[model samples]
Target: MTVLKNCRLLPSLTEGYDQPTGDIIIEGKHIQRICPPGTAPTDSGTTIDVKGATVLPGFFDLHAHLMFANQDYNASVLRSQNEYMLDSMEYARVYLKHGYTTIRDCGNDFYVGVSIKNAIERGIIQGARIITSGKIISPIAKGNKSFGTLYEEVDRPEDMMRVCRNEVVHGVDFIKYMITGAVLNESGEPGEMVTTPAEIQAIVEAADSLHTYVAAHCHGTEGIKQAIIHGVRTIEHASYLDDECIELLVKHGCRSSLVPTLSIAFSLFNHFFEGTILPEFMEKAKDACEHVIEGMKMADAAGITIGWGTDFDRENFEKYVGLEFTSRAKTGLPNEAILRQATINSAKIVGLEEKLGTVKCGKYADLAVVDGKPDEDLTVMKKLPLYVLKEGVLVAGTALQQEKSYE
Candidate 1:
């Protein structure tokens, strides 16, 4: 048993605990009870006073690529495969340290993600609760392999079910398909639809047969509409979303969500004139950067279910990982609503709402402690959390900052 004493609760992010200050009791991996401050028996368990700092449920990232060796496209492919595994493990630990206790890793090769997820479950590795996808499924286009690629190649729609079944057999939790080209791929056009409607149907059908859902990497307006019409559950990086796309999401009744990735766009704008970026890559990056935030604003306005994601890579991880908070705040939405995207909304997206999103009893004891109230100032998230706990085990601490900056 463990008791978190004198903790300030964020009402917006909590349920079952309504008091402004209270103590949370933990038994094994679940929050056992909530009582008024100092009312619980402190007889036999460890007790930690959080010194009145605010405690919130740990955050989530519905879209994260956990196995990249570096931020560069070429480096991710050219680096030694052994080194990639090491880096990916370290990335998981570091991300947990940043207060994200749950993540759905978008893709990796060799089933590395599923392997590490099993490792974490076995207590051999310290990291988040990982839900992962197998190798990216993409068409045999130059964009999928301009330099070198980790994607599993396919051409005809007939091959989709077989490829998806192979990934499921290898232990992936879900299917990730490329509905449109990526900006970082040198030979690809970012907003152009590359996968046909038949391909989408095939992948979705395959995933449904396996009792899972499909998450698509989409950026173009037309492709976004196609994905919604075809029953894609989660849309990653809907950077070009428009009115018709919003209408389709509302009309479908399928509860499809928009996961806008603001980190990539913010990173592009941050490093636009660095001179190391290629000209073609810069052009596509510019297009995605220009419209993603506005797209998020538009989708939010239409009562669309907007979830949280930060398409972070190694290079910009530190600089822009938490930029999603400030970026969503720019949509003129309340700070509380923006915070919910990373918590409850994301939980609903992954179908884990009752188990993970709030600071309530009977839920897993996954949480983060910070000095400031994140509800009032979302930028406070940029700092590494003061204390992070995953399933009642304290995983990260020891970093303290009197001052921190975006630079």
Candidate 2:
């Protein structure tokens, strides 16, 4: 048993916890009790004094490509398989150390995400809890030689169903399907619809049968509406969402949430030069960056659920993940709302709300203790956590000393 004492707890936006400063008792992997500071039973368990740091639920990233390196699509493909896997594991540690305790890998090539997920579960590595969508499913375009190994390409509804089932059989936590072209796909435009409604529905149905959900990679307003209409669980990178698309999202009860990956667009537009990325791609990235913030404002106004996602690779992971807080703040979202998106809202997106995302009793003891109040200034998250805990075990920080007295 372990006890964290004298920490300020962030109130849950979804489930409220009244106390501001408290002691959290962890029995095994779950939080057993939470009480005012100095009130926890002190007879036997170890205690660590947090010294008034603000404690929050461990952060979650709804859309991440864990196996992809931060290189151009062509260059990323040339990496050896072993190098890719090792880098993925290293990236996992990077994310965890930065305060994200859980991540949902949107897509990956060669089932590397599944392998990494299994390794983490088996205690072979120290990293974030990973939920993986084995490989992305997309429509095969004829003569599209630029298509890499990242996708399982299919055209027919029946083919979509087959791939969905295969991914489920391979132990995927969810299924990811492309409803439109990607910014990085050289053969198509980002806003162009690539899959038919029937195909998307088939994929959704297949995932539903196995009790999992589908996350659609949609950038255009038309594709966003199609995905919502067909029951996709979350719309990723809703870059061009408009009023009608926002209405469809709200009407559908946001069982299909929106995950606007502003970080990718922001990274591409500001950090890269003309020749580093295709000029057309850079142009689209600029457009996406503007449209995403506008869409976020509209979605917030319409009360549509929005979750945090970076869609970034290893090289930009540290630089971009926390920048999401600043980006959304530009959309006029309150810092508290942004915190909820990263914690509770994201947990709901991946269907892990009850077990994760809040610092209440009975939830998993995954949390980050920051040196300042993030509820007021989210930029504080850009700093390494003062203390980080996953399943009640200290994974980062030097907060605890062997002989430090709790009193």
Candidate 3:
């Protein structure tokens, strides 16, 4: 048990935290209660004085690839299996240190995500809670095989179910399937819909049988409707959305979250604009920015929940993961709305709102104490958290914790 005294709560993250400063009572791994400062008995556990700090729920990144070591697509095949697995283990610590206590790894090479998830659970490592999918499920295509075991290619539409179930057998939390081609693929259509409705249904059925869900990787409007209708739980990178696409998403009640990865698109375009990237990738990035921003506004206007995720390389994780928040602000959303997109809204998208998102009683005591009011100043997000707590325990931070033990 731990008592975080003099804590400040963000209104959006907590339901009834009316006080200017309160004490969070954490027993075991859950938040037992929140009370007025110095009101709770102090002779029960360790108490930390945090009077001026702002307490917010730990951030969530719903779309991530823990094993992507290469930011450059063409040269990605250079790394080995062992290298990816080892680097991923180290990257988990990075996520926790940066105040992201929970992350849904969108895809991975073969089994790294699952292996690392289990390792964390078994106490073999100290890291963020990892929700994982197996190798990416894609149709048979030349470019799909370029990333080694990162992709599990389906030879025919009928094979989709088997591929999805195979991932379940390997102990995945859910399935990640691709419905459209990507800009980085060496030999494939970037925006074309590759799978039929039947294929989508088959994958959905397989995930449903396991009592899980499917996350569809989509960058265009062609298959977003079918994927949502067929029950893809989350839509990754719906970069190019049309009126019909937005309509269908709302018509379906927006049950599926639209995770527009702005960091990757802006990163690519910025590098190209600065003459760092090759000529071939310039046009695609430019075209992606125009459509992605437009789609984001349309979704926001329609009241659709926009899940947050940053799609970037492993080596550049620290440098670019924080960019997603600022990039989201550039889309015209206020700082409060942008912060919600990363916290409560994201937890709702993954169906774990009851346990993970807020600083309420009975929820996990995963939290970050920042130096300023995030809702007023968005750039504060880019800075390291002063202190991070996971499951009622101090895990990582730079400041000295002046903890007092009660006898």
Whole-model lDDT, model 3: 0.80
lDDT of 2 by residue, 1-407 (tens): 88888988777542445878888888989889888899987778777778898888898888988875665666777778898788888888887877889998998877888888899889999889999998888887542445357778888888766787899888898998889888866766778899898898888888898889999999998999999998999899999999999888878877789998877788777755456667777777888889998998899888887898988887777655477776677788888888888888898878888999889788999988888888888778677787788988777653544444432
lDDT of 1: 0.82
lDDT (Cα atoms) of all candidates against the true structure? 0.82, 0.82, 0.80
Which lDDT value does model 2 have at 170? 87
Give the poorly placed runs of model 1, Cα more than 4 Å off: 146-149, 319-321, 399-407
Give me the displacement of residue 320 in model 1, in angstroms.
4.4
lDDT string, candidate 3, 1-407, tens digits? 78888887777778656776789999998899999988876786777777768888888888878876656554555667787788778877788877888889988875888999999889899888999998888887777876776888875666766787789889889899889877667655557887888888888887888788999988868788888888898999888888998888888887778888877788776772344345556567678777888888888888899888887765666775368877787788778788888888899998879988888989999998887787887777777787788887787765644442322
List TM-score per model, in order: 0.94, 0.93, 0.93
What C-alpha lDDT, on a 0 to 100 scale, does residue 352 get in candidate 2? 87
Off by over 4 Å in 2: 13-16, 41-43, 142-147, 272-275, 398-407
Model 1 TM-score is 0.94
